[model samples]
Target: MLQSSDYDPLTAAMRPPPGETQEQREEREAAEAEALEVSNRIDAEIKASKQAMKRQKKPIRVLVLGQSMSGKTTTIKNFQMIYAQKSWAEERSSWHIVICFNLVRNVNTIADTLNEETTDSILTGRRSSLTEWHRSVLFRLSPLRRIENDLKAFLGAGSSESVEIHHPNRPNTSDGLRDSPSAQQISPPEDAKRPQEFCIWSSSGWKSILNQVKTRSAQGKESQVPRMVRAVLNSCKDDIHLLWNDPVVQSLLRAKHGRLEETPGFFLNDVDRILSTDYTPGDEDIVRARLRTTGVQEYRFTLDKGTGTSRDWVMYDVATAWIPYFPDITALIFLAPVSSFNERLMENPRINRLEDTFVLWKTVCSSKILANVQLILFMNKTDILRRKLEHGYQVKDHIPEFGGNKNEFSSVLEWFRRVFRKLFTDNNSSLNRKFIAHFTNVIDTKATQHTLQAGKFSTSRSESMALRYGCFKVQAAILRNDIEEAGLM
Candidate 1:
């Protein structure tokens, strides 16, 4: 018997039969050689896999929080355009259909407004503002409504439901907002009616939907739908223009709905260019294109920072309900459309949009789980805010707390900045946290790119400082242990 310490288990297991012939011995040797080669290959693969894992950096997780149409998606697009140029270029042409849909939907919205006004006047037996000429224009432009439906269908499954806005449960007043005196003034609309707003469920994969539309548009049999849509829009172009420009339709749109010009994805002003046969969306048009997100969306990109180092970044465009789930996020980009001071959420018409943003911001700041995460507040849509101020829309009219401050853009912007900063200081419990705010018009590509670059530099500096601080703590602990070991304490 072999001693336990000296046992050769591998050799014993590989021992051949006792009556084996020379040819059988040779076969056994060959089989053993093949097995050894296979084992070596697997070991090499495992070693390579481990090396690759070691080379890969952990993904930086970012969460983008904002209410609907707050430029969250547009901001992500900017990141893609800057860092993932190849993919952005590939998807650029696919936005043509979406841009067309936006234009068509705006026209249809105008038509619907006119119909509602006309019907209400008839029911009330009031003198109608709509003339026979207006009636004729509406009749001629009816094809756009069908085109909108077809475009929605081509967009994919959840397209029908995209017309309905789902109102989330009103923000809990207990989430830091209840303490504010202004919170009492902000209430939901008495009539909580669901309005028709175009949105896609995040689960449906909107990029894939756009790609499918592009693919089908190229195929012969499936190409007719897009062609038909183009043909209808082109034919109705003149009538669409007439109706949109008509004083009666304009008055009705203004009275029933707010300025369509102020609306997200308002392309009516570019109907002539958009309806042209060779129209391709410019960067601005694509950025401004409105598609409301109904659920959480995540995006990933590999960024090379030019120092022979690259990092993977994963960004989550999340709904309010999903905020708490990402406690370990590297950063939170909160977008508040300061321009929406006078407007209400399409989902919940009762609460002022800006006020809603305030509540959301406070809630985010007060979350203990997110206390350590870097917070970046984007006071987005400053362009729209400037326009509103220029148009004489008073900030005091919507936000009483704005007081008698000058309604000028600079004053209003400063006031918003101060308010946001106060909220941040009040709610955040982290002693090491920093407050970063940027007034951004994310749709303006050049301006947004500059801001993003500055943001990246600031974040890098902060991270470097943190790393040095951690190293200092580690060195201090080691020095203390050395002193103790030396009996010098």
Candidate 2:
């Protein structure tokens, strides 16, 4: 160990000459004090400004995209829920709005992860929905707040006593005005809660007074206080309605509106219950039960819970939003059914002429997309093929070992992978090395079966499975690599 007295290279180099003058040393010390004071002040102000900026800045925007029923909604729902829960714990303020349109309800087909047979009636913009009032309430809140001060100012109040419009409007009245007979009769009781619940005027009284006014008007007599009060209330209601109809307020309302509904536990409970029912339920029974349950319209319920977290997704169908603004879309989640490609590659005329029909892929590869485009192929309905392989007969004698029913599992996977790889290469690497293809049979027993049969669904699976898995794995790894290089997470 080195002693403190032992010469240190850094200290020696920084040391001043022993013969330095007293005046020079005094000047140096004064300069050093001034420099330290300046640095300290700068640091204090910088810290204060940083804290202030953090409070003022907006939350980061994240955009998500996936094909219809490809777990897109469920993904977003899960994300929103998780964001609320975790972000709440982290003390971070975050909010989300989901826009769903053109949904078809009550189909007889098997559903994906986050689909419901019917969306909430309010979300569908239909009257008679129980949640209609709730929908209106949410839409009203944001715009009301934005124009709260304006409304209060319009109603003859200054900024000091102005309340948020969502709160009850309390009119300022002096003690003399409160004691007046006309005012006491017209003003509501103190115990009344909301403006709507408290009747400002008696309907029967108003009717009688209005009749009196009409009768007097017919006789050429002036109308009284009752007629004037009636006119004032009607004018106020019309003003409120006009505020709701304002174009800027309406646009802001649309930007802030969202719909949420609870999911039924039928599928979650019954599926788990069925799994635990007997010591030995056959694979066929399992498959049939899944098909039956999946055919139910509860697919939408999952979007709100398990897979719902990914709903930050904005479908670019409406360019009126921010979709057109961000020219660099980093990734794309493409939806193409594995069954469609397998069963209809030759039969579907549109697909048969792939060069003519694959306009979306070509567009994605164009200069606009190529700068940042990354493709994720969601191979839907893989469960259908897995079931066929499990139950469908294999080629009999004289077939190679790779053609066996068990090997067909690998073979089927290979078939899809090869096709996707070929398509990628044929299209001049639209995704370049960033192309990833994966199979998803969300409602089927196949994913579990593939996991069980293939012993973890990794090494023993086809090159295609690897390629698909590689997409996510590689992206994640690249992120980690960047983080490591930056000495972050």
Mind giving the per-residue lDDT tens digits that candidate 2 earns over 326-438? Answer: 45434444544433221211111112111211333433434343444455455544554465456552322112222344437667567555555655655644433444555
Task: Please list all clashing residue pairs in model 1, or write none if there are none.
Answer: 189-350
Best by TM-score: 1
Mind giving the per-residue lDDT tens digits that candidate 1 earns over 265-349?
8788898898786788887787778766466787876654322346666778887778777876777778888877776565445
| Cα lDDT, all candidates | 0.68, 0.32
Q: Against the true structure, what is every candidate's RMSD?
A: 9.0, 26.1
| Model 1 residue 340 CA deviation in Å | 1.3
TM-score of 2: 0.32
In model 1, which regions exceed 4 Å deviation? 1-9, 16-31, 159-194, 215-223, 303-310, 446-489
